[model samples]
Target: MSGAVMDEIVMDGLRIDGCTVAFGGLRAIDNVTLDIPGGTITALIGPNGSGKSTFVNMVSGQIPPVAGRVVLKGQPITGLRPDRIVHRGLARTYQVPKVPKELTIQEVISVPLLYARSDRPLPSGVRSAADLAHYCGLRPAVTTRCGQLSVSDLRRLEIARALACRPEVLLLDESMAGLSLEDTDQVIGLVREIHVLGVTVVVIEHVMRIIARLCQHAIVLNQGRLLAEGAPQRVLTDPDVREAYLGKGFTL
Candidate 1:
């Protein structure tokens, strides 16, 4: 439970206050509020179309919330452009790999590195890119065309690309979906390694194995509202969470 508490950061904090998004009369996300502490991994889980992706989209600046505020490090970042958000220390990956078909894996990762390059003299951005790919276990596909990579390999490449941005916080959506057990384990390790580097991570996933293994804290949403938030084990066992996800057959 102590691990669920929000931690202070040099930048304000990642905060969502009373955020809601509506499509027509239906609320896709209803009045949800969440805080992701710096340097920790937070898991957001729910049944399909339960607003997990919409909420993350709002936070990542891909879509603006109809009502609510998103603040990062004490500054109001709501409605900011995606590129601006990245520059402000937020990076995001998608449920589907969005890599350019024409680009080599190296070229794909290099684009973000080049864009995020700082004036600070250290290893070249390319070297950092190499390290990111190697660290994420995508080294074998470094020279492969994005179109040539398998779904699991592309998933790894997407994560590597996000890391290349040098973001302080990352939003990973369904990163382990459609992966084999071995691939899932690899992703779990990559995610763990990323958090160890002091980068805050908010993961949206349907894989219970991942939620149980990688997240110290979890948030559950249903019908656009927050149903639960707490330690992963406790949250998973909650009556409300089970009802929302598993219905009557849910047990343990």
Candidate 2:
């Protein structure tokens, strides 16, 4: 290589540039590249084993891509560590919510805030741990132990904990995985409310109704590549998208 330098492009939000991740001979994510606009709720949907989780991991810096890079606002952030990523205004939730069995709901919210960068932007209702609990619909069981709360409440706690990080970009990974219909609707509304509070949100969800309700933009991934992306309604109804991923039954 010569002594050549590349200039950075001013991007509006998180940019994924030709990111690739492979395991042994299998490519979990194939040279995937896209941008997530700030201050909007975008839905990421795909069938089983379609690389949705892997993509979220790459963006959150949980696992670095073997190739390409991730940039945030013209900065080459792929080199930064995960905590640094969080401090730079990026945070994510997991598919399954877990907490110390001994920790109460209030304590669980406090732990992340204690470690978070003080300069990060605190989301709505984060002034006090109890305030966040109430915001997340955990007011009735504010002192409940993690192991004691119902599964749906546990899921709600995950979002509240992530918010304590005061992130500008929040990635939610299957946060509604095991919720009932009514609970799912409630969670969906909560997500929208969070977005309205000025946080850019990306949701990794399989629930079509939830996506249909919350997102105007949708990115569909199949076999670890960019399959289709655009308005959720149009992309979800594309012939190739329906045939290869959604099946014939799925339609607007």
Candidate 3:
């Protein structure tokens, strides 16, 4: 399926071409580059203010890059509007699920489906979103208001909503934060299921266990620069990663 090309959508694997983003006087993403292979999960991790979220935002079009570009399927998409990027088959989820407090889980997911279709009635995919919510262990909370939902359910809802967009590539920004051990495991499984459905994922997380379990390839960033890239275990164990995490006390 990776070899099959989808019409009008560039599926040539997601690539970042020397991207950089700065705020005020500080560089948030410093000439960083990476690739998220089609049908694979890539994890990016870094300490606080290390540029993980900044880079993801730049690629997802929430923030414009100061230099370089974000490419999908071999086409340049950097600095495009968020809606335009969504039409390009890319969707992003935030650490906190941006649910409307007035809406039920069903309504929250349904609204996006309505907007995606515009003049037409809601599509059959609305039911698909429900099923995805169920599979993600959110069925019991289906009618609950977004304000009443727990952190895990909120994360599930966000993932379901992103799935409703029918994206080829999904950017998950710290989706596992503020969850219990059991809830985290459930989310990790749900992510695996999503990948099985052919959506390539780029996950930016600080939780090491989630990254190790789900990411086939890992990118380690420190102070807004690439520190290491390789298999999960190796990248996590790299000297620079240890130093970044533990400062001078980190030792081999």
Candidate 4:
């Protein structure tokens, strides 16, 4: 990447500072801090229960942090509702992309367009449902019910819906889980296109290959704490990360 691109990413971002979340006696996230630069794709990787999803949750406001704050573009957005956060230029997708089973692919994608803040309109501008379907590679299934589409298509549809919000920051949590390699690659390609369009995305994924291909920065969490942060190659290679996630006997 050029220095300009590097600077563009480094200079602006979402900041998760000293954020913690607990469920009864169990601390799901413990004082984790991470910086997701603007105009860059970041991977949040760790073993199950490492608090990756919890961190994304705190940022997206599905759940509030027990302590600490989440900042975007230097403004605190810690405890805002999901819709409020979406309007503030951040949106997210779940591991299992949830579309209303009753809605068509077009209706699913257009829902966010109606509620999302108008300050950041979609690049294509609001248009026919077909336009959104074509943009999201769901043209073939435009009229299809959300329940009828395949899993891969659902994931793509989720991205399209998220983009309909015109977010400056997008958090993707395990969208590739359970997907075939080809399907994972398909979503990865779509995400890359979104990133190229200037959306900073933070993806929580277990597949290292996907991380390597899509993320410029990687943050590793283990047992509710940050274990490593940096380029994917370096962070994934850290001795502690290897032990906690890749297993001691594994090598990349």
TM per prediction: 0.90, 0.90, 0.88, 0.91
Would you list the rank order by lDDT, best first?
4, 1, 2, 3
What's the alpha carbon RMSD for model 2? Answer: 4.7
Predicted structure 1: clash tally: 4
Give the local distance difference test score of model 1.
Answer: 0.82
Which residue window of length 10 is worst by lDDT in model 2? Answer: 1-10
Better model by lDDT: candidate 1 vs candidate 3: 1
lDDT score at residue 34, model 3, on the 0-100 scale: 76
| Model 4 lDDT per residue over 1-252, tens place | 899875555447898889999999988999988788888899999999998888878788988999998988777898888889888899998878767898998888778888886576565554756676677666465888998888878887887888888899999988889989877777888789888888899999998888988899999999999899999999877899989966878776
Of the two candidates 3 and 4, the one with more favorable TM-score, higher being better, is: 4
| Ten contiguous residues with the weakest lDDT in model 1 | 117-126
- Please give, for residues 1-252, the per-residue lDDT of candidate 1 as tens digits: 353343444243588889988889999999988877666688999999899888878888888888999988778888888888887888889889877888888898888788865432222333665666777788575777888888998899999888878877889999998899999998998888788777789899898878998998899999999999879999988988988887877685
Any runs in candidate 2 off by more than 4 Å, and if so which? 1-10, 246-252
Best by TM-score: 4
Best by lDDT: 4
Q: Is candidate 2 or candidate 4 better by lDDT?
A: 4
Overlapping backbone residue pairs in candidate 2 total: 0
